[model samples]
Each structure stands twice: as structure tokens, then as C-alpha cells.
Target chain A: MARVEVPELPPDPTAATKVAELEVPPEIVAQTLGEYLRAWAARVRAGDSGVLPVIAGLAVITVVFQAISPHHVFLSALNLVNLLQQSAVFMVLAMAEGFVLLLGEIDLSVGYVAAVGGVIGVQLVQPATTRWPWWAAVVAALLACALIGAAQGTLITRLKLPSFVVTLAGFLIFNGVVLILLLLGPFSGYPSLLGDDTNRQVLYHLMWGTIDPLAGWIGMIVIVAGLGLALWLRDTRRRRSGLVAPPLGLTLLKIVLMAIVGLTVVAICNINRANIGTVAGVPWVIPIVLAVLGAWTVLLQRTSFGRYVYAIGGNPEAARRAGIKLASIRTWAFVICSFTAGIGGLLYASYLGGMSNNVNGGQLVLYAVAAAVIGGTSLFGGRGKVMHGALGGLVIGGIYNGMYLLGLDVQWQFIVTGLVLLSAVTIDALSRRGATTGSVAHV
Target chain B: MSDANVARAGAQPNAAAPPAGEARLQVRALGKHFGAVQALSDVDLDLPAGQVTALCGDNGAGKTVLTKCIAGIFQADQGQILWEGKPVHIRSPRDAAHLGIETVYQDLALADNLDIVQNMFLARERLRGGLLDEDAMERDAAETLASLRVTTVRSIRQPVGSLSGGQRQSVAVAKAVMWNSKLVLLDEPTAALGVVQTKMVLDLVRRLRDRGLAVMVISHNLNDVFEVADRIAVLYLGRMVIQDAASAFDRQRVVQYMTSGGTNGSG
Candidate 1:
């Protein structure tokens, strides 16, 4: 083949060298601990605050509660443990909403979906009824919730309906479903876990039981060590491959923070809390919440499915063009969301010792969304962690517990939570504006 | 009629005689219509490896339509597309990708919240044990950008939203060319870019041709077309009015063909 003789134009002299002269911002190329800190400061200034605001808010709430509560009961070991136990349901529910929220969608039906799940699990394990194994009952309940999520997801994705509207409809329908399920129960309108059957006791123990103090200490150590090792290995491997990795100091700092948190939780739980009998050990609910957090964090940060969720939330058009099955991923997100909500429902039922029609599903759903937002998860999507749910739930739980200790009414709790939710959303919006305007230096 | 014939006669020598093994893609009598509105009709285009072809046209002249047809976003209503001298069907974007054809759309189709490495390896992420292999992906993304001489980005870990307009365009182009693509179609790669950024993108276009990949650029900027294009094809309305060596036509003549569909106003 003869080469075509095309007329050659003289190369533009400036074009060949201009790009190489472009300077990369220093913070972006930070390699030391000091530089990393500076970069973090810059990011926070620009509105990518990460978890700083949430942590600071939590600290303020704790301090205020400690100062204002009568006899300073807020900081007592008994109260702290009680707070965590109460927060468990909220934390799980927030996490359930987090999955869909990260995709810029919402599942308002999760509250009642969780209640339905609890009702199913409690009814199944009733000795006079089917008397199913606790594990089997839990699985069946979660599966039922998953199916509910899938049905809602299908309507939203396949019909191209707005998630807000579809989930709102689900919320109403599931509320009725929960009511009907409870009414159909053998116990009539309420299914209590107050039976002597071993299976029933197991279901009841999920929220009310505690591990031995020694076992709690050992479990804490094992978890901390395992997580720290994983973090170290991953960062070291990346650095060895000449890729971008956090500095060693930063990594060490993170590990230390994790250890400190683990030690504090175990120590507090190890203290005697009961007024009469010996009843001090880490609550089973603590590990359950932690496990959920860990699983979700991995799904969102280390898996392709998680990546696609973020991508879809950030830019659905881009995700579609990238060949992502947007409908399928979205449907799966709803399924996961409802399934998680089912777990939360089970805990709620166990905490109350029964499933009742009086379970305010509306208030619970609102709290779930509020907790997620307050914990630093953006309602606008593409930016959240499961840890945010846990932290936010603690904040919500703290306010409720603290307000009650101060002799304040439940109305006061609602007002305070509303204020916090508004502030968090304001922060999210402001930061978004800052990011878009390039007000902060390099991100 | 006489002037149109004369212009066609002049282009015939170059258009009719692409060297045997040099033409990487050949579109013959391609036609497409959306309902009653014909978007493209009887279009012929040749994209040869080791060269850049600038497809120039006005609004509604079907420049994007032709590119999308080849990119497999839209199927042609009639005619044939020959890839490496074989008639092949392109029914979807996936099929086009499998055939080594990639397109960088006008919007860039990038998630702003994701970092450069994530956006570059969006759908085709490398995986290890069912987890995203961030290390391998980062290494490959860095290498691809380096090979393209896209040095303006601060860090591959920085979000694409943090990058300047020029850098985003560079990333988008790098992503398109990363998968060993034989043919790259860039639709208005320099649109909304500053003067310096436009120059940067044009230089990148030249580099792709130098690397022996067939590049088709849909551009309305005549200066940019002349700057980087080796072959110029002008689309008038729904038909390809002219396809010839860049040396055969000057600015005003190419404009005449673009606006009038012929050198004379008769078309």
C-alpha cells in the first residue's frame, strides 16, 4: 500500500510544550503527614468536610447532655449503655435508608417494612403458632422485606416513577400490612415474646442479651486487630506498587483512633449497670450494629456494585453510557434497603419484647432519614458511609435519652431533632456549592 | 449543477483511491431516518489508520448522526459499514466497543463525584477476588494519561469535578483511547474549552493519529479542523457533500460546501 502524501502543516510551537508546564497543586501531591493534614484542612474549607462536622456535633451534644441532665446521669455507664441499646434500631434503619439515599433515592416504606418483618419473625416463633427456629424466622422475615423492596424498586425503575412518590405509596400500604399482620396473630393485635420456649427466648435475646465481660473484651480485641491489619496491608500494598496511598502516620493515626474507640466501648459496657443483679457485659446489639456497619462499608467502598451505586447517584446519564444496568442496580439497592430495614424491625420488636400496632412507623421513618443526614450522609447522594448512620443514630438516641432525663416531653425531642436535621442539610448544601464554585483549593 | 459536478470531479481522485490496506473503516451509502425526518442519507466516509478525519457540518447537517452510526448508538437504516475490509453490523455500543470503536460524547459522559481513576475505569474496572482492584486500576489509569501526555491533572485520586475544563476533556479522551481502540470518535472535544485547552485537545488528537489509530473528530471550528485533520469530510444537510485530502480545499471552499451542499449555491 502506497502511503498518501498529505500536505504537512508546521507544528504549533506552543502546543508541544504547554501541557508539560502545567503545575499540579501541592496538596494533591502531598506525601507526608503534615502535608496530608494541610490537604485535609483545605478539603474541609472547600466543603468536603467528611465526618468532622458530625463528630464535632456529637461531642457538643454529649457535653451539653452531661452538663444539663439532673445529677449528671447522662455520663453514667448505665445510661450510656441504655443509649446504645435504644440507638440500635435507629442505626439499622438509617443504614437501610443509606443504601437508597446514596443512589439519590429514598425508601419511606422501610419503617413499616421493618415492623412487618418483626411481626412475621415474632409470629413464626410463637410456641402456639408455627414455632419456627429463631434463625429461620429471622431469614423468612428478611426475605419478605426483600420482596417488598423488590416490588417497590420495580415500580420505581421499570415504570420510571419518581422514587419519592413510589416509596410514599409503599409507606402507606406497608403500614396497613403491618396492622393486618398483627391483627391476624394468634395473640390478637399484639405478639409478645413472653413464652418459655427456648426458640422464643433466643429471638427475645437478640436485643436484650449481653455477652460475658471477658468475652466482650476478647471480641473487641479480635475485631480491632483484624481491621487494623487489613488497613495496614492494603495501604502498604498500594504504596509498594507506587500508587497513591495514605501516609504511614495517617494510617497509624486511624488505627489508634479505632483502638481507642473499641477500648472505650468495651470498658463502658464492662461496668456494672444493673440496680439489683449482676448485668454488665457488651450488649449483643452492639456487635450486631457493628457488623451491619462493616458489611455496608465494604459494599460501598470496595465493590463494583457499590461503585455503580455512587456513579448512578452522581450522574445517572454517565452511568447509563458506561453500560451500567441502571434499573437492575437500582432495584437491587431497594431490595438491600428493605432487607436491612427488616433487621432493624427485628431489633425494635426484641427491644420492646413484642410487636405492637402502636409502633409509630411514620416517626420511625422520619428518624431514619434524619439520622442518616445528621451522620454526614448527603441527601443529594453519591457521598455517604454506613458509619454515618450509626453515628447519627447515636446522636438521635442521645437527644431522646438526655431529654427524658431532663424531664422534657417527647415534643421537645422532636423539636431538637428537627433543628439538627435542618442544620445538617444546610451544611450539605453549602458544601456542595463550595465544591462546585471551586472555592476551596484542590480537593 | 456544473459547479457541483466540477467539485465532485476534483475530489474523486483522492476519495475513490484510498490505499488498499490503509483504510481502517469505510462507510458506504449509509442512510438513517428518525420517523419522517432523515438525519443521514447516502453518506460515504473513509477513516484511514494513522490519520485524522475531521467531519465538519452545520447544525442538523448530520455530523453527529454519522458518528453515532459508527459508534453504534444508532443503527443505520441502509447501506454497509466495512471494518478492515469486512462488512460488519454494529447494533449496539457494546458491539462497537468489541470492534475497537470508541466515542467521547459532547457531554464527556463522566461522573463528577468520582475521581479520575474511577471515571477512566468506569464500567471496565479491574477486579480481584470480586473486589475493585484499586491499585492496578490506578496504575493503568496513570499510565494511559501519561502516554497521552495529559500532564495538567493534579492527581489521579482527585475528583474529576476538581479538574479544569481542559483536564476533563483530556481525561475523557484518554478514557476512550485506553481500551486499545482502533477507531476513536470525538464529538466536539474542544467545545466550551478555552483557547489553550482547545490547543491541548488538538495536540492530543494529532498524537492519536501519530500512534496509528483512526480518529474521527466532529468539529464546527474550521481552524481546529485544519490544524489537526489530514482528511476533511463535509456534511451538507443529510448527505456527505465532499470528502477529500485537506490540501485540496481551503477555508472558504469548505464553508461553501458545508452551507450550500456544493461549491455553487445550486445544491
Candidate 2:
């Protein structure tokens, strides 16, 4: 039999044949990403969830308070710098709380855990016995806190227990541990090594150290350049994937804001703040906090673990059916919460020059939780961001500082915090109810 | 292109006659119990391809239980559900989805918070990058609705809660269609619809049949049953009393069989 000549393969069989031979009508083209985004925004505006409104209201209130303040120091450069420094520790702790809250869970042990972590770290560099370097001590402190968190996480997840009960237990146990550690002093079997004052100096130097002007400038440049590269890479990937991305103008605006904030902080710290004419720069802890926030934000927003945390928080049964290891995500969430709290604890101790037995747990846990909630994170779970912790913590810290500047008692600060937390939760609950009831337009 | 012509053309493409020998979905002596209560017992039913089979019964007739069992919401205490003649056990909603069986419960189980595209892609979402691929998902959702000729919805972006009863039913039906389900079990889809809306939903049932997907409709409304169903199965007190071709029994006999615990020769 004569072999039939095979037809040459079409360059693109599906498209070419559909156009030339199949007589199929052309498919309707989907909207461009930009066009679709504009439409989506219009829709959001018409029946928007009120997250932006809430955020805007908060900003307006803050600005108005600053404008009306008797002492114009509320908007002064020095005060702003002070505000950033004060917010640093609280931001870390609040963010740690945010991580657990996103999974519809709570961790009450962070306060004491942080205290314990700080105490342990400081004790590590005892000149009388252990001659560990500052970095080593810091690492040891973090490790201790992480272990505490992991232990609590394991108990809650493995036992299928409520986080409220488990973390409550953790709070008591860790608090006792802290007292024990502090009472025992540094864990040295023998004394007579490096002098005590040298150990004290090392601890002080590590916590409050400043870099040279050139080093500071160099560090800022590296950070900005690295951030620029990352943003550019992300934008490129999004575009290549045929996805929607923020407008270039919007991105540029964001970068400019970031630079202004960064440069202003650096410049203020670089100014001579020394009564004895000492060269001043940002506390190294500032950069450390920023780095931690950036890393944790990426972990929470970009990874599968983060997605599962949100999913479980939103609907546990849905997550279970999706084959997500709920227990593992929750455990890790608790672990991060404790770990970050530990960091905050160490920073607080460093800033205070030493950890004390008088460190309050009951009040600290409330502040941390309130900071996260006030930052616009949903207490109900499945809806929160790391940035919320930073923003919320700043707000709470600002209230404390503002009231102190205005000569208000500590009681008023507590009252303001309580009201803010209450308002945030009430707003969250109302919006959720509105969405469920199909009254989103009202929202 | 005229409405009359389209209706005439669609009227008989799917012949009123049942398939000669092929059973699309077969439930063989299915049984289920809740502690002491026998929710279902020895329930046998056959759903044929290109036909709207009505599973009709009163308030406590084990209709919901049987549908749930087939949809894998609840495991049958004893029995085999043969899908395309293969013995299978449906242990979960996901399993039922894999087996091309979709169930629209009484609540419709649609997340009111989510818009049409989101609700349609709930549990099963499209992803282009790392996040929810909104563009791709909306396009696919639009296409799916368009193929079903679901024009009741003014916009897919609108929340399901804003839709009329008929439109919501259409969405639930569309969601099932998106899963490429071979058999869709609808629980009282037209329970709350007005006359015109009910007609719209009935027409949708007919369209589903024309598309060659077996449909098992659970309804209390006999008029809806007589209007759209090709075969009707009646249950009373957790037992299947009669299952017959819709032409075999009129409304009177079907109601009698539904209420009394007696078999009718028409079945």
C-alpha cells in the first residue's frame, strides 16, 4: 500500500485551526489587568468593606491630636525619634501576638517569656564566670524564648487544647521560671573570671551601641538599595505572570515615603545628642526590629504556612478537608508568637538596662493583645497582617507618650488603650455582620 | 434566533424517552442510621442520563439523608452507590466531587460574604501567581454562566445575597456545572421561588437534562415535579415506596404513594 504523506504539523494547532478551519468564533478577550483593577476598585467603592475608612479615621484622629497639642513637640523631630524608639519593642511584641491571633488563637505567655529570655541573655555574659560575646548572649536568649514558644505550641496543637487554657498555663510556668532564673543570678558553677563591671559594660554596649556616621550612612544605603531591588524583582515577576500590579507611580510614591521615613530617622539619630559631645546614631536595635518585621511579614504573607493559618482561622473544617496540617501551622504560629515576644522582652530589658522581678505579666499580655487588635487585625482570625501590629503598637505607644507629655496619669493611658481595642473589635464585628447580611454597601 | 424557534429546537433534542439500558446513577439498598433512628433503610433508586428524576416525599421522608449519603456528607450504614456501574463509597464532599456528583443542599451552602466568582470557586480556586487568580477565575465563571445561558444575573461581581431566589438557584446549579458533575442532586431548589422564577428554575432543570447530565431533584412541590421530571421516586418514613416514569403516574397517584406506605402498580 502506498504510504500517505503526513501533513506538516501546524505551528500552533489549537489557535491556527480554530481560526482557519474549525470555524469556531473567536473567544471574548478578558479585560486588561489595569482595566479590571479599576473596575474592581469601583466595585469596592460602591460596596466597600470599611477597612480603609477605619484606617483613615485613625490617621485623622492622630493628626488632629498632634495639631492641637499645646506643646508643638508632638510633631518635633526629637519627639518623633523618641516615638520610634519607644514603639520598637512594643511593635515586636504586638506582631508576635498578631501571628497567633491570625489563627484564631491567643498566647498569654509572651510577657514573662520575653522577661525570661532577656534575663537569660544578660546572665550569659557574666564576667565573673561565662565570658560569652554579646551576639552569643543574644542568640542564647532568643533560643531560650523560642523553646518556650515551641513547647507551648506543641502542648496546644498536639493535645488539641484551647490556646487560652494552654497559654495561660504557659504564662504561669514561664513567670515562675523567670523569677527562679533571676533569683539564682547567672548560672555559673564557679566565680573569679572576668570582672563584674566588664560584663555590665559589655551588656550595656551591645544594647545601646551606636555606629560611626559613615557606617550608618553605608548601612542605610545598603538597606534602601536592597529594598529597591526586591520591589523591582517582585514587580517584574508579577507583570510576567500576566497579573495585576500596583501602578508605577504608586510604587514610586511608596518608595519615596519609605526613604523619607528612613532618612529622617537616621538623620535625627546622627545629630549630636550627647551632653558630653558624644557621636550619636540610631540604636542598632532599630535595624534589628525592621529586619525582623520584614522577614516575618514575608513569612506570613508569602508562604503556604501563612495561607494555611488564614484558612484555618477562617474555617477550620474547610482547612481540614483541604489536607492542610492545621496542628502544624498553629504550632508554628504559637512558636513565632513566643519567639518574637522573647525578642521584645530582650529589647525591653536592654532599654531598661536590666530585667527585673517586678516585670508585670497580666498588664503586658493585655497591652500586646490590645496593640495587635487596635492595629486593625481581626480578633476573630483569618484576617490580619504583620504591618497591623506595627501600626497598632505605634498607636498605643503614641497614646502613652502623648498622654505622658500632656502630664496625664498612667491610668488615662490604660483607659485610652481599652477604648481603642474596644472600638476596633466592635468595628470588626459590625463589618463582618454587614458582609454576612448583605449590607456591605452600608459599610 | 427568535425565542419561539430556540424553544422549539430545544424542546425535543433530548427525547422524552429514557435511555434504553444505561443507568447513570444507581443506589443499591442504601441504609443509614443515626444512633437509634433509622434515617434511611434499603433505599434503592436509579437516576437515568438526560432526565430530571424527582425524589419526592414529605417533611421527614429520608430524602435529605439519601441525597447527603450520595453526596458523601454522611456515609451510608450499608449499601453501594454505583456511579456508571462502578461500586463506590463516598466518604466526603470532596470524594463526591471527584466522583462527579454535586449536591446543592437546602441552604445552598453558598458563602454570602463572597461574590459570585468567589462563591463559585470556594474550596476550588484558580491560581495564576501565589494569590487568588481573580482575572482567570472571573473569566471562567462568566463563561460557565454564559454556556448555561444564565441571564438572570446582571453581574457576576454582585454578591449572591442580592440575587432573586431564581438567580441564587441558577448560581448553585452553575457551581455544580463548573465541577463537570455528571449527576447534580438539588435539594428543594425552587422552594421559595415565585411563579415566574419557578418557571425560570424549571427551564434550567430542562437545560441541565439537555446537556446530558443526570439530575435528581428533591422537591415538595408536585407541580414543579410534573412540569420538569421524566421519572419520579417517592419515599415515606425512610422507605422507598414507588419509583416510576413520570408518564406512568399522574399527580393523584404519586401523592397517594408518597403519603401511604403502599406500593402502587404505576411504579
| Best-performing candidate as measured by DockQ | 1
Evaluate candidate 2 and give its CAPRI docking class based on DockQ.
incorrect
- lDDT to native, each model: 0.84, 0.72
**Runs in model 2 lying further than 4 Å from the true structure:** A1-72, A123-162, A187-287, A315-332, A433-443, B1-15, B106-180, B190-211, B221-230, B247-254, B261-267
At residue B246, candidate 1 shows an lDDT of 82
Native contact fraction per model:
0.40, 0.02
**Candidate 1, superposed: residue stretches over 4 Å from native:** A1-28, A437-443, B1-22, B264-267
- After TM-score superposition, the amount by which residue B55's alpha carbon in candidate 2 deviates from its true location, in angstroms, is 2.7
Candidate 1 lDDT, tens digit per residue, B23-67? 899999999999999999889889998678899999999988898
Candidate 2 lDDT over residue span A248-271, tens digit each: 544555577777777877888787
Model 2: residue A186 alpha-carbon error in angstroms: 3.9
- Could you give the CAPRI-style class of model 1? acceptable
State the lDDT of candidate 1 residue by residue for A190-286, as single tens digits.
Answer: 8898778887788788888899999999999999999999999988887777787778888888999999999999999999998998889999999
